[model samples]
Target: MVEIEKRNSILEVGAGGGYLLNHAMQRKKKNAQYIATDLTEAMIKVMCQRSNLEALKIFYAGINLFLLMKLKIL
Candidate 1:
């Protein structure tokens, strides 16, 4: 079983390959919808292609940094 991060670094900056997200999805503990929101468009495409999760429902969207500011996330 993959160890869950204490802080759950899902929204990390400069997360290029998305190793953490892919790792979590591989663990089929529950049937759940996973959302992969990234700051970079290239990362979004790469993760969707590399994840290769057959049974997982994934929603990958590239969120702009400006939008984050509007949402008061930053």
Candidate 2:
């Protein structure tokens, strides 16, 4: 299991409908930030419809920029 800290920033790539992200957010600290990105606009729209995710920062991107940056490819 992943433990979220008070100042942690959580990013979820390919978050389809945000099922896992939503649950993870529940365990996050109040000051923690959650960002979810998906390849399709439909999935982002679906995530936006969830009341529990209203405060979530969502975006639509073709690829996982964070992963690429971690791998030093970006």
Candidate 3:
């Protein structure tokens, strides 16, 4: 489990519909920043439509092979 503190910045990758992030936001400090990213526009749209997650910063992004190589994750 991740421990969130005040003023912390949370980044959730591949956050489809933001189910977990939404739940985490309920318990997180108000000053904390939550950012969610997903590869698919459909999932991002779904998260955007969720009224409970209006405070979240949503983006469309994906990790490609080039990034993996650059990060030495491949």
List per-candidate RMSD values in Å: 10.0, 8.7, 10.1
Question: What lDDT score belongs to each candidate, Candidate 1 first?
Answer: 0.42, 0.55, 0.54
* Deviation of model 1 at 47, angstroms: 0.8
**Global CA lDDT computed for model 2:** 0.55
For model 2, the superposed segments whose C-alpha errors exceed 4 Å read 5-7, 52-74
True lDDT of residue 44, candidate 1: 54
Better of 1 and 3 by TM-score: 3
TM-score of 2: 0.63
Q: List the residue pairs that clash in candidate 1.
A: none
Report the poorest 10 consecutive residues by lDDT, candidate 1. 65-74
The count of residue-pair clashes in candidate 3 stands at: 0
lDDT of 3 at 23: 69
- For model 3, which pairs clash? none
TM-score, prediction 1: 0.44
Q: lDDT score of model 1?
A: 0.42
lDDT of 3 by residue, 24-52 (tens): 66766666666666666567667766633
